[model samples]
Target: MKKNFKLLMLAVFVAAASCSFTTKSFEDPDKDKLLIDLITYVLEKGHYDAKQFDDSFSEAVYKDFINNVDPIKRYFLASDIAEFEQYKTSIDDQLLAKELDFFNLVYSRLDQRIKEAQTYYPEILDKPFDFSVSEEINVDYENLPYASNKKELKDRWRKQLKYTTLSTYYDNIEDNLFKIENEEDYTPKTKAQLEADARETTLNSFNDNYSFVNDLERNDYFAVFLNSVVTQFDPHTNYFAPPDRDRFDLQMSGRLEGIGARLQKQSDYIKVVEVISGGPAWRGEHIEVGDVILKVRQEDETDPTSIVGMRVDDAVKLIKGPKGTQVTLTIKRVDGTIEEETITRDVVEIGETYAKSAIIEKEDRKFGLINLPAFYFTMQDYEERNAAADVKKEILELKQQGMEGLVLDLRNNGGGSLRTAVDIAGLFIKEGPVVQVASNGKRKEVLSDRDSEIVWDGPLVILVNDASASASEILAAAMQDYKRAVIIGSKQTYGKGTVQNLLDLNQWLRNNDMGDMGALKLTTQKYYRVNGGSTQLEGVKSDVVMPGRYAYLDIGEKEYDNPLPYDKITPANYSPYDGYIDYESTIKRSNERMAKSAELKLIEENAKWIKQRQDENVVSLNLEAYTQAIKDREQYAKRFDVLEDYQSGLNFKSLPKELGLIEIDSTLGQNRQRWHKNLRSDIYVEEAVSVLEDLKLNNIRQGSLAKIKD
Candidate 1:
């Protein structure tokens, strides 16, 4: 119902613009009377009570309409500004009456313009839109800092309309919408029906100016705007609208009384993005990712109320409540089965929010795996207690634990603070630039570590997948450029290199009385690696590439609309690590072993099997096929050996009394021997260890280092 307010307001605004309503025209008295009568007719039909049409409300509405509709406000000519001086001051009664007449004249002109616009609106539907006509869509930053003038606002609408209309032709909206359903439930619609529906939906809501202005009224627009503003001040200071604020409050302090799942509005239907790790939904084992939520029923409710087309936060409110309360969700599963599941909510603690460390012992070498879910630090907490210092302490502990090699798993780590990323990268590098920021043609600021102390410098590797973005990409690129760590992951990262400036649209137009125009997230700058490569569309490439499920999908910066173009800048002079480890021969040997091994060969050969599981669109029409698909996928994934297998092999190698002597001596020998012996059993871990050993043996190992006792 709260969401409906925004939609209704937009509909009313659009309807008003489309109607043939005008004010009294001074040039033609008869036309002016006709216009006034028309306005009266609309007012009556719109259910605006004639009795409640007070002077104050009229003034407010009139001012709002003028600001919204007047082309002069968006782009006021010098002469027009001069002409408006007569209306600036309060006048005598006689003069006031004349001024109102002049105002009516201007209002009538705007009314005529709107009527003229309607004629073209229907024509836009009939005409086939050609998107190839590229126009220079650059905004004049100097002239219009904020779109306050009416003409400038119209131009913004023109550009927005052109882009949006062009986009509709390229995007298969029907396919995207229908893709939410499971393949089994998919009743294929004829191409004609799909096209007709798509076109109708698009055309019915095609007014650019109305949408542009209406978005300024919706809470999400302000939520994103305020987030941008707070982010500009610092990444942690966020602005949340009512729904977002409610969600945040629930996540931080509220108890979950319903199913524990984070939902998002994916087009029309609500899709489950994540199931709370230990919540009832996760424990129930019925809900899974990619499942569409159709309805939700409260404990006392008899009928399940449909939740389709509801905002994510609204759906969340319906699903979340006090602990002990039961909530039922009608879920459409990935396999096309719709089922109702009831869950009792409880307190949800975010245990998986931080960086978790694990020791994966492959052969003999123990590799420390640190999975950083997000580069997060509460700014308020940091201000009160030293958070960066604490993270450094943890890294030092991992290093002290006798970790031969390290894997910084940054999968699904949507970036948080820039400050934290730089600080974390500083733990690896001694003292150098980590990332560079170029904004508004100002002197580029190089963020670097001033500290000389280094931690975990032995053999470092960073693992990332498609979801690794922003600050994650920044750190990965810096480490890769400096040759500090070997990056192993998918083809590239989610390339979001541009920086945005949060402009308070309300603040800029305070004098104009534009209530809650919200904030604008204007892309103001871009980040560049110290080596001069831009991380825009082409994200950082891994040193050792690994196959990922989303490898075939168009996953990165190129998939977004109006993504900033990638460009290079002057490279800052920085020292590269001169010391190299001799891991070449060991890597070659490990690669040969992995290539010929039947288990590894089988896993590699079953790429298609993995792909089918990864693909979101691959659906089964029947229960049998779906069961078989799931079975086949599970069987193929199990070909990869577990960590215990490597440990068993290492134990087996030390079975003979003579093998114990070799093991003892190997540990006492150079780090390379210890690494080689440790890597022998765990294929992948051993491969990384061998690479480190080869680097050490090659005499290219940089910096003076000492091996610490575990």
Candidate 2:
């Protein structure tokens, strides 16, 4: 099944084989123009459902590029938009002609506007906001119009800045009051002082944003323009710059050669958000979340470059290097102590990206729950470590620990390797056609598990949500089609039927002097279920629908712009699993139980409340009205607070093997403890386990638990 995914890639390679791209000299020396030419060529030659470069396409690119540059209409004026509208229907022609006139004009104009806009925020925050004035700001930015003139634009910035500073101002007052009562010899600040502090904080944030914006190079904006052009083909299709491609590779492999500390830019400092377990940062205990990285110095360099006010990307470049290299970081600890720490970079594996399992005990029965965060795998070696293999190992371990049933949690799993999805699906059924993939003008290929061995044939439950997509959908749809598992969670999974192949653009060049050309994630094919249904826009429907936070929200692939149309192909020859006595009855029982579940009803109510809050975007600028509105919402929200405290009463613990590992690695132990605790309180997991309990095995699959216990 894994090899078949490679064959699909082979087909993509073959489709573009005729192009015979090489490092041939181009008359156009501009890299941006060259990229446009190369990208458009690949799109036309390789995209599964390629679009024509017509006036309509040009119009789409124009609109999307403008939106990409200034989404909130805060930068560009009405006159600027009117000027941009002239080339709205000419972008497609420019793409084909390898011209960057439109992109150049917009980029230069945006640069000028941003520099001018910088003067406005600091001036606006200079004077204290009149919070007593009865005013409101509609934050539906998409529908909002550009400012008609400079005065209107500044006014727009005023309302937005006031709205932003208002919350902080109120918080300052509340915090000061609390400190006055609680702390000994507390210095109390007046409302005016608090307002000034709030304005300063807002001003600092603006400065940080402008600092980042200023750090952006022309190549960065070109990447945005490239993506705006490529994504017009489909949402999944994208152009990744060199750095972004590296990140994509790291994400797919879940391994990177670095110190393994996830950093975020806050105000001016690059703050450590998470120190990945088993990495140098975690091992040395020199860095922790909330520590601010002040400077980075390589072992080869005598001087340390101060990272204050630098973009996080640039700071990261300074920190990350070849494995075995050393980098010293000047850190300001959470406790306010400044120190220098040197760390040797190494290949850090992100444990969270892999499959993790927990055994749940309910009324003396054991059930296996494997949470597959993503269908991760090594890019170079498929057998090294992967989601499917790890899951199989976990299942076997759970079986050793007397697991009678299994719950494969695909919630928030945005999908990864297609091969792993096929292999994972094979673990349940003996052998069958798992999914059917189709490319343009090619025969449909059915990716099946050729192996006849059934790893776990007992009762099964698949937990999913709107975030479960691509490979996740493939697995869930396969199991559902086979009637081998009861699908639980959201009303439907994330509808991402299309498959993307990451093509390194540098491969097309030979004897090339140009630096890394980055990569293109092109949508190459669309996959369908064995039952012939496409999960494109209509993702896999849950056997037992449950209310979720996204229930009332427009989410998933259906919400994406320019998504591929949903269509079905001829069904693959397959038979449903006969292990279930009555699969329909099992689903019905779960549905009835869910219908009566008070916890689920409460969750549904909370979801509706969240949706209502999201819909109410207009906010009052008056401090008193805003504070009252927040208090009123919080007062109404108190009923939903019990949802967080709800416990399934199920006992979740790591298997014996993991328990041993946990004993040595306290971080892993803590993470597992937190996960198990969350599982215990998770209403969805509780319901999934309940469904597992209801799923009975036929005699053919009976005594499997007994065999496992043996």
Candidate 3:
């Protein structure tokens, strides 16, 4: 499945790039004249003129930008209308005199704004944005014909601008600054004190904005501006000029050049989030998540530099380097003891952040589980061929190997291609409607299964948590609506049921010669379940809710800024699953079992552990306190194992033995075990097996059992 997916994604990337460059003529105005006029103006005024800008540069930036921003050739805003009025005869004068100045002025203002915003960023690190006092601010668009004339609109603008200023200020401050302790000058403000001050400032600013803003539309506009500006460059080339991108890459890829541990920003400190599965940090068994990084130094350096309160990303850059390089990290563990560890860099793979599967066996029944780490597909691989088809093939192979039921694990799956999701869901049910999309009230599209075959017909389950979002929610919601599977896991999914369209900014501004201003991924549509419910902030509720580690954390769709409101639509007609086995009793029994299990109890106890980790933000001047903190967390974590012994009463010694076969290579054998372990933790798979068992038992009890004679 992985191999096929990689190939497919590669194809998609190539196709996307090709499609973007294939030019088409515009319907309005003279295309050649417009292009020449814009190009001439750009050449005269742009910092890099026609001599510096080649054909590739012109096509990439100017043409692409026009294609994205002015596709329709009709102005949507009064500002746009006014701007075009000046350039009616020729845009050359405006471009040379005013437009260049505007771009330069805007860029300069943004730079200054970023700097001003950074001054208050430490506050956000000290105290995160508080949304507890947020109230639903609705807009009365019906009464307000002209937004400029409405008094309420003005008031909304005032409040929104203030919040926007504050938010931008905070983002800039956080993005640019790094916290480091001056060990030699520890006379007045301690690291903790500085962080506290920053927190207070952020909270105060947040409160000021929250108290004033009273309209959702105003808030949305503010957010849109911020996002649009950041997205104006290449997708990976962000406005954050700090060294944090390298750190972010380390975290997302689950690999670092130097120390093999995951780090996160906690208040002001760079805390260890997790030790990579088989990395240097994990091998040392000293550095763990919840351990605070206090100082770092090169192996040969004499003085260990303090890094407390530093931006997590910047700190990560100072730590990570080329392979075989050595660096020393001074860590304050959860128990408050501080220690320094010297580690060498090596290639590390974040194995945890990928798709895996497992098997759940109870009594004589066996269920297969597939846990998708993320809805990730390399762009090039997907466009050449469909990855979902490969997954279906794997599912069939699992079924052929004696799997009776299936569990699709989508915890922390933050969605990918909409097409892939539709295809994947189509694998289970017969050709039918999967999801309904509503846009502009006039356009409603029902994405359905055009395929005619059903891959697996036995009991099915889908496990989701607060992190299960977008495409993940789509599949889970579809199954639940069709009564084809039972949904299990958190109380609700991460309700991100909206779709986005990625627009190339360069293409949009094709005739203007603006250089690549990048692209804008805009929210275009909202997805709805077949039954008509929209999974916006209110995600899909699980039929059986399970305890999750992130229960206390604000996760999912509700946590996003200016999220779209949830609304329902008229129900669409679709055939229901035939003989859908009732699983209420099975759910009850599973809940009862989970409630009694000591292992499950340990998982529930992790909430307190997580909170304790969050609360101990203050770092110590003394090393003992830091070391103790790390030890305490390790002790607490050791109280419960992440993986349980599910094979105590089973017949096999090793995973390969249990499967009753050997793969061609050790890598394949290891992959199979990883797949099996992922499948075992699948709550949905467990529920499905129980459901099927109950169905069988109930039939016998009622003398309605139909035997399939061989």
Reference-based lDDT, each prediction: 0.54, 0.84, 0.54
Clashes of each: 31, 0, 64
Better model by lDDT: candidate 1 vs candidate 2: 2
Q: By TM-score, who's the top model here? A: 2
Candidate 2 pairs with clashing backbones: none
lDDT of 1: 0.54
TM-score of model 2 (CA atoms): 0.92
Give a tens-digit lDDT track for model 1, residues 223-300. Answer: 321232122222222333334433443332223345677776655678998876667777678699999999999989
Better of 2 and 3 by lDDT: 2
Question: What digit string (tens of lDDT, one per residue) describes model 2 on residues 1-710?
Answer: 00111111112112112111222223233666668878988999999999999998888889888877776677899999999888999898888888888988898898898888889988999998989999998777777788999999999888888877897898898899899999999989988999999999888777765655665655667778888889889999999877787778788889888998999887778999999998877887879899999999999999999999876777888898889999999999989999999999988999888888998999989999999999988898989988889999999999999998999999999999999999999888878899999997377999999887678888899999989999999999999999999999898988999999999887877876666687899999999999999999899999999978668777789877899999998899999998888789989998999999888898888889877777775889999999999899989989988877888899998888878878878889989989988888898888888888877778755556345435
Off by over 4 Å in 1: 1-242, 245-349, 381-391, 441-443, 501-522, 583-710
Model 1 clash number: 31
Error of 3 at 18 (Å): 27
Q: Write the per-residue lDDT of candidate 3 for residues 227-309, one digit (tens) a residue.
A: 32222222211221112223334333434466677776655578887676567777667687898989999877889888775
